[model samples]
Structure formats: structure tokens, C-alpha cells
Target: MPATAPRRRLTAALAVTAALTMGVTACGGTTKDSAGKEGGATATGSADPKAPLKKGLTVAYLPKQVNNPYFTTADNGGKKAVEQLGSTYKEVGTSSGTDTSGQVSYVNTLTQQQADAIAVSAQDPGALCTALKQSMKNGVSVVTYDSDTNKDCRHVFVSQASAEDLGRTQIRLLAEQIGGKGEIAILSAAQTATNQNTWIEFMKDELKKPAYKDIKLVTTAYGDDDAQKSFQQTQGLLQEHPKLKGIVSPTTVGIKAAAQYLSGSRYKGKVKLTGLGTPNDMRAYVKNGTVEAFELWDPAQLGALAGHTAVALESGRITGAEGQKFKAGDMGTFTVGKDGVVLLGKPTVFDKSNIDEYDF
Candidate 1:
């Protein structure tokens, strides 16, 4: 990928403009603490931001699960970032995608291992808050990516795209697919997922717009990010709403599973489907005419951004404060925004004509 990719360039330009408008000073200095650990230095105070106890920090990435292609590609990006920074990297999680408690257990263990920082894609927002808060209290820098926990529980959140953008984009795509006047349903990952819930809210809000006034959202189903469960839920959606014109699944797992169910069913071409999906996962579906198009940000880029953010937090280059800037390897400098959130960029729409250009 080009260093000045369109998304990165746009984000960088916007970040610079926001920083100047906010009058936020760049605080990128480090100082040694009593324990000889390097920590971030505040611009106007003696207070030192916490940092790793050792150099070449260890960053543990805990996604919703292991072996899921979405997370696998994401973690691989993190691994590359860690390698470039000469940091120790480890990826750990449960095989069950929606196992919130299982993820908590992993957080506890990683905390016990004295990992320098933890980068996570939360399965459930509130379920992981207590564990993440405790991890932060244990001197571990917590960075949530993909799906966020409570804002107070983590240092920074690496968001793939703004919720409004993702939600509105999905709805617009579905509306176009269904001729802008039909009943559509949503197939989401987990009911408690923060990102999914937020995007769903925005989707509902987008439907209220005049352009989508003719479209009606029929129902929503939770797939728990499990292929079998998602497949069953897709079947249920079709069976319960035979006249449903389209379905939007904002999760990679759910979308792929929904596509599988649609491809093998009688409604293959009758009911339209569109949402956030990877090129590779939806390629066959697009080729078979089971799906027309979908949209998603690069998960690998999101992971790499998260990895760089974790390293910055652990190494004391930035304190996760608004306007703080840090270099994200080849992605360039990113500024922390309000609520300690860092936007990765915009989502990309993928279809048969250009799907082959992307591998992840």
C-alpha cells in the first residue's frame, strides 16, 4: 500500500486542521520516573503519565476470538507494527467469538504476566469494563480497538470509522440495492457490542432522513459472531419476514454467514444484502450474484494503528490526551481526539470490479 494512501492522507489533513482549531499543544516529551521507567511529561505539571517498567515493551493483543479471519488479519498487522518497533508481541483470545467472560479471563492472565500494554477488540462493552479497569490499575496501558469498552476504562480507542459514517453508508447501500423503498433488517454481531450498537443507532437515525423515508427497518437479529449461529439467524430473518427486501450485516462474521445462507437458499437473488465485509470473504458471494456490494475499512490498517497507539502509550510518547500526536510507522502521525479516540479513516466500498485489488 502507498504511504500516502487516500484514507491516511485525508485523516492526516483533518487531524492537523482539528488540532489547530482546538489550540491543542503537542506533548510528546518523555521523562524518567522514580523507578527509572520512561513516562510521558505533562506540558504544565509535574504529574507523570504511567509507562512500561521495561524497555522493548510487551504488547498483548486480545481480540474477540482466535482463528477468525478478520481478527487474524488485524493481529497480523499488529505483529508487523510490533516488529518494526522492536517490541514483544503476543496474540491471545478464546475460540468462541462472543465469550466475553473468556476474554476477561485472558485480560486477567495478561495482567498477571505484567504485559506492558493490552490492545483489545471488545466483544461486550460493559462486560469487559471491570477487567479492563483493573488492568489499567495494574499499570497496564489498555487500548481498545474495533469495538470499544467504556470510555473511562481504556487509554485510547482506535476506531475503524465514525459510527455515523459507517451506519449511514450501510443504509445508503442497502437502500440503493432495494430501490430505496422496502423493508430491510439488520444482522449484527453481539447485542452488547458497543461499536455495533452505536452504528445500529446511527443506521436507525439515517432511515429517518427523507431519502430513506420509504425504507422501513423490519427487525434485527443477533448472530453472536458465530458462523453457525449467524447462518441460523439469517435463516430466521428470511423465514420470519418473507417479504424482506434486504439485509444489512455490519459485522464480518455475520455478513459472511448471511451470504452463505443466502447463496444456498431460494432468496439468493431475490433479497439483497449489503454491509461491512472484507473483499476476500465476500468475493465468492459477489461473483455468484448472491451479493452486489458492501463496505468496510481496512481491518489490517485499524490493527496497525492500534498497535502503534499501544506502543505510544507504553513508551510514554503520548498520554492519550486530546491533541497529543504520535508517529504510527508508515501510517504517519495521528492525533488523539475527544474522549481519547483516534479515527483510522473512512470505509471503502467493495464490489466485483475492484475486489481483486485488496487481499485483506
Candidate 2:
């Protein structure tokens, strides 16, 4: 059930950087995010779709850096949905995924250990929004999966898709592998990652359409997600664009350190690489051809829908508004669109014919 692509509606340009923040890209440094709003999280309750999931209640994952196999398969899929809804799952963070003051002191030590939901992944986006809106004004339940924060810092954000469908599907999968034209470039991750600057503003509004009018784009190399600065910013973007034909790297540690610097240089298979990686870290650079496709999602079903949307927002069943619907047990019924976000869909692209049928 993790192969998606059709569903789009949440519009009106919902800001607070409308959701996105995959994993495996850490190391830090960058700020300047708060454009006003600070602390005071509101949203009291009343959605009761049979409100039954409220067991031992503790849920605290907080990622952006940890033992790191993609946030350890998304905090072990939020410790398998907070131990299958009986709750009480814990994991804390900060090894420098832009250590926003160690993710604001691990959200004040998981709100002084009263932990009733944290699930963060932000590393700036208003510098952890006043300690996650004061850990939702002390009652906890914040939920901001994979790299988000700034819809006034969390209450619901599980998104892994539709930042204009992952920036026009990473520029239509690198303009269908550099055919529709040439000269691409993006590298990215940590220009104060508002989900890679909202998917590089829809990959620069999908290269202004017209079927990407002969591509172009040419520069943008940030690699602060560091793997020796994304292998020396993929060798300073092919030595300052030596006619560079491709690259997108929307960060899975910048497309496996720019596919280990184009599978050991001489631009293996002559440039052309796509963004967002991890099918076991781009399976030997897509079996030695140095990547021809890429995309992501199913970081263990995006940490099991951010552990069933933080146990369905502490089981009043759903309160994060915008068409609230619930049930995520077997990974199904999830609605709540618009700025409360919740969109785990449309991502799978891999390559080498299904990238060996996926594993990460």
C-alpha cells in the first residue's frame, strides 16, 4: 500500500511551509525562521470517531538525527505505532540535524518527561517554535514528522508528499532523465530547510513549465547535510558546472552524497541524478549506473503516520481539523488536509525497475 500518486487539493497556499521533511540528512547550522507567532497551541478537542486509543499514553520520538538509518527507519515506525496503540514509546534526539539548540533541549526534556506526544523532526523553522509551542502549552501532543515546524510549530504535519507533489516530482524526475533538455543542478538540504525550502519552491515552479523549456536551472549547492559537505558539494557542482547536465538531490543525505560523488567521478554515466534517495541508500547507485531515478516515502509508512497522528491527537479521535478523519491502524483512513496537513502519499519512484522492489 505504499505506492502512491493521485490526490491533490489542499490549496490556498497554506503557509508555515506546507509540510515535508524526509530523513537521512543531518549535521547542522542555519536559522532565521520565526516570522512572529511563538507559543500558545490551542485546539482543545471534539472529534470522537469512537475515541478508543488512549492506553498508557507517552509517545515521544523527536528525530532529525539519531543512530540515523533514516531516523532508524523512522523511529522504528514510531516504535510500531506506539506499541500498537497501547502507547508509551520513547526516543529522543539531537546529534546535530541542525541542532536548533539541540531541538530546543529535546523539547524541554520531552516537556519534563510528562511526554504525551512529541514526534518532531524539525531543526529550525522558527528554531523549534518556542520549544514546540511550550510543548503544546504543557499538555504535549505536537506531531511534526520528518522536517517541519511553522504551521505555528506542530499539532499535525505528517506530510511526505504534495509540496506540490514533492516539487513537481523533483522536476518531473529530472526532466525525464535529462532528455527534455539539460543543465540542471540543486544539491540542497539545510538552507534553513523549510522542507528543502518548500521543495525548492516547487523546483522553481517546475522550471516554469512549457515542458520545462529546455531545462537550465544551473546552480544551488548547499550540502550542509554534510558527508564531507555532501562530498565537497558534489565536487563544487561538477567543478562549477562543467556543462553539468543533471543532479537534484533533495536530500537523503543529498542523494547519497551525490551518489558518492557521481560513483567515483568522471561523472559516472555522465551526470544525470535525481533527488530524494534511499532504496538502501540508492542501491549501489542504482546498481552501478550511477542513479537514473529516485524518490522516497514509506520511511516505515512515514513513521507509521507519525505514530497514527500522535495517537489520533491523543484520541479524541481527531482534532487537528481540516476534514478530520481517523483510523490508521493498518495504515488506512487518514484525512485532515490543509494546514493541519497530514498527507502521506505520492512518492514512490525509485528505479532499476522498482529499485529491487524497495527495502528502506
Q: Which candidate is the best by TM-score?
A: 1
Off by over 4 Å in 2: 1-5, 16-51, 55-97, 100-102, 113-115, 122-222, 225-235, 240-270, 277-293, 298-304, 312-347, 350-360
For 1-360, candidate 2 gives per-residue lDDT tens digits of 457423322222122111222233332433222212122223445577786787888787878777656776767767767787787677777666777787787787767655677788886778888888776766677888877888867778887887888888988988888788988889887788778888898889879879989888978888767678888988888888899889888888888988888899888888889988778778888889988888888776788789888877766677676787887877789887777788888888878877766666
lDDT of 1 by residue, 38-97 (tens): 222212112133443234878888988777788877777787787678887788888887
TM-score of 2: 0.35
Off by over 4 Å in 1: 1-55
* TM-scores for all predictions: 0.86, 0.35
Model 1 weakest lDDT span, ten residues long: 14-23
Looking at model 1, the pairs that clash are none
lDDT, candidate 1, equals 0.80
